[model samples]
Target: MNIENYYNIDAQGQIVSFTREQASSFAKGIAGDFNPIHDEDHRRFCVPGDLLFSVFLAHYGVSQRMKFEFSGMVVDSTQLIFPAQLSSHMSLSDANEKNYMDIEVSGDNSKEAEFISMLSEKYVQFSSKTFPHILVPLMEQEKVMINPSRPLVIYKSMEITLDKLSGKQIELSLKEASLTNKGKKGEVRLEFAILSAGEEIGHGAKNLLLSGLREYDASQLDDVIATYTQRKSEFLAVA
Candidate 1:
C-alpha cells in the first residue's frame, strides 16, 4: 500500500493533513491498532501515535540514532507542518504552532526511499502489537488497569540506536517490556532489537504513559479484552 495514501502530505511544503477516515485506516490497516480512541466515530477519537511516527520517517528519513518525544495528541482533521528544514532536531506542530512532537536524529542518516519504507514498515508493525501481546500482560501483572470508561495510554517517547544499518529488509524483535507504577499513573517501556539477515544491529525502546489507572478487576479487564478482540475480528471480517 502507498504510504502517501494513508497520510496526506505535501512534501514541498512539508505539511500534513489527517482526516478521521485516514487515521482509522492507518490504525487498522497498517498498525493493527484497534484502540477505540482511533475509531472515527469514537467520542475521543485521536490519530494513532504510530501513524504520526511512520509519516515522519517516511518524510524525513531515518537516522542511525533517533528519538521521538510526543507532547500533544493529534486529533482528526488537524493540520500539521514539518519543520521548514531538516536538522538534527525538529518539532512538529500544527498551523497554530502548537507542538505535538519533538524529534532528534544523530549519526548516519538515510533519506533513501527504500530504506525509510522498510524501516518504518517493520518498526510500526512491531510497535503496534504492544497492546494485547505486551501491555495487557504487563498491566495484569502490575494489578492496575487504565480507566475502562476512557482508556488513555499516550505514546510518550521512543528512542533507537543502531550500530550500523544497510539492508533491503529489516526485522524487529521484542527484547523486553516492563511497566512501572506510581500512584494512579503508570509507565510502560518496550525494548526491541533490530535484525538484518539474522544479525542484530540496533536496539530501541518505546515508552508510554498510562493515565487514570486503577486497581485491576479481573472481570473488568476480561471485558475490556473481549471488547478489543471483538473489534479486531469485526474489522478483519469487513476488510
Candidate 2:
C-alpha cells in the first residue's frame, strides 16, 4: 500500500512512554500468556514479540498515517528471528517522508533489530489497514537475559497517576508472553527496553508465565516442527 500520503506527518516526531505492566498486558492479549516478569515485581525481564509489536501498534495509532478501529488489519506473515525482551521504559518516534516513513523504537540494545524489523512490517500492514492493532507493547527500554539465566513469565496491571504528562502522553502497556528454552551454549543473548521523551520509568510490574506454555520435548528437525506447531496453535487461540 502506498501509505505515505495517508499519514499525518510528524517531522520533529514525538515520544511515547510505556510501563512494564502495560507491556505485559499487551503481550498477553496477543500471545495469550500473561508473563509476570514483564510487569512490576520482576524488575528484570520482558516478552520479546510483545515489545516489538506494541511499538508497531503505537506508531499506527499515533502516526498521521492511520486511524484506530477494531476491525483494522490482517498480517500477511510475521517471522520473529530474535528475542525481544522488555525493560523499564519504552518509546516510539514517527518521521514522514515522500514515499515511506521512518520509525525508531528505543528499548534495550539487545532486541533493537528484531523489534525494529517486526514492528516495521507491522507498521506497513497496519498503515495499510490490513489488521487491527496487534496486542504488542511499545517500550522505552528492553533487557535480554543470557547465560544460565532463570527464564520466567509475568502478568500485571498499572494505574499511572501522571503527575505531569505533557507534549503527547502515549501510555505504553504490554500483555503478551513468549519464552525461548535454553538454546545452544554459544548463541547470542537477547533483551530490550522502551523510551519515553528520552526518559525511563522505574519499578515496573512483573509475574512468571511458564505455566502458560505447553510442554514439549524434541531435537533436530522434528523438534523444530513440533515447537512451531504448538506455537501456531497457541497464537491462533489468543484474543
Candidate 3:
C-alpha cells in the first residue's frame, strides 16, 4: 500500500498541520496555564502537553483506506515516551536519517526527561480511544452513518435504563440515501430513527455516522453484535 495516502501531507513531509491557536490550546489544556505566552502575539512559551499532542498527531498516519480498517491496526505503544518543547513559529520537517520514531525538542536533557514522563502518562490516558486499535470503524458508524458499517453491531454488553429520560437503549433507523462525488469530496446521506424497546423515541438526519463507526474494535465486533441482537430478540419475544 502507498504510505503517502496514509496521512495529511505537508510541505515538510509531516502527517499533520497545526495552527497557533491549536498549539496554544494544547499547552493550556495540559499545563493548566492560561498564560499569554503561547498566544501568537504572546512572549510566553508552550508547556509539555502542547508538544506531546503535536508530535503525536504529526507522527500518526490517518487516511481513507486506513479509516476502513480503523480498529484493526495497532500503533507502536513504546514510541510515546516523551514530549517535545515549543517556543515560537515551528513546523515539522522530514528526518530521513532517523529510522526510529522519537520526539525531538530544544530543551536541556533534564527538562526533556521530566516532560517526557509527564507527557507519556498524559498520552496514555488521552489515547484511550486510539490505544492498540485505530478506532475508525466505531467513529464512522456512530457519527457518519445511521446503519452499522461492518454488517454487524457489536458491544460488550448493552443495558437499558428505562427510567432515564435520555433513552439509553435506542436503535437508529435510516431513511433516504444520497450520494455526492466531487473530486476529493465524496458524500453519502442517511436518515435515522431512535427506538427503545421497539418504541420510537427520536429521529433525525446524520451526515457523519460513517466516521463514528471507525473506532470499533475488530475482535469484539461479531461477539458484541450477536449478544445484543439475541438479547433484543428475546426482549421482543417476551413482549
Query: Which candidate number has the best TM-score?
Result: 1
Q: How far is candidate 3 from the true structure (C-alpha RMSD, Å)?
A: 20.1
Global Cα lDDT for candidate 2 = 0.29
lDDT of 3 by residue, 1-239 (tens): 11122223345543343345554544343333332344445443332232433344334311111101011111212122211443222333323232222222321222233233332233322322121122234333433222243321111111111122233234444444443333223244434444555676444332311222233354455554455446445544653
Count of clashing residue pairs in every prediction: 0, 79, 34
Candidates sorted by lDDT, descending order?
Answer: 1, 3, 2
Give the lowest summed-lDDT range of ten residues in model 2: 131-140
Candidate lDDT values, in order: 0.86, 0.29, 0.32
**TM per prediction:** 0.94, 0.26, 0.21
Clashes of 2: 79
Name the better of 1 and 2 by TM-score: 1
Task: Write one digit per residue (lDDT tens) for candidate 2, span 33-97.
Answer: 43334444555544333344345443432221221111111111122221132223332222221
lDDT of 1 by residue, 43-65 (tens): 88888888888888877777899
Full candidate order by TM-score, most accurate first: 1, 2, 3
Q: Which ranges of candidate 1 are over 4 A from the true structure? A: none
Report each candidate's C-alpha RMSD, comma-separated, in the order given: 1.5, 18.2, 20.1
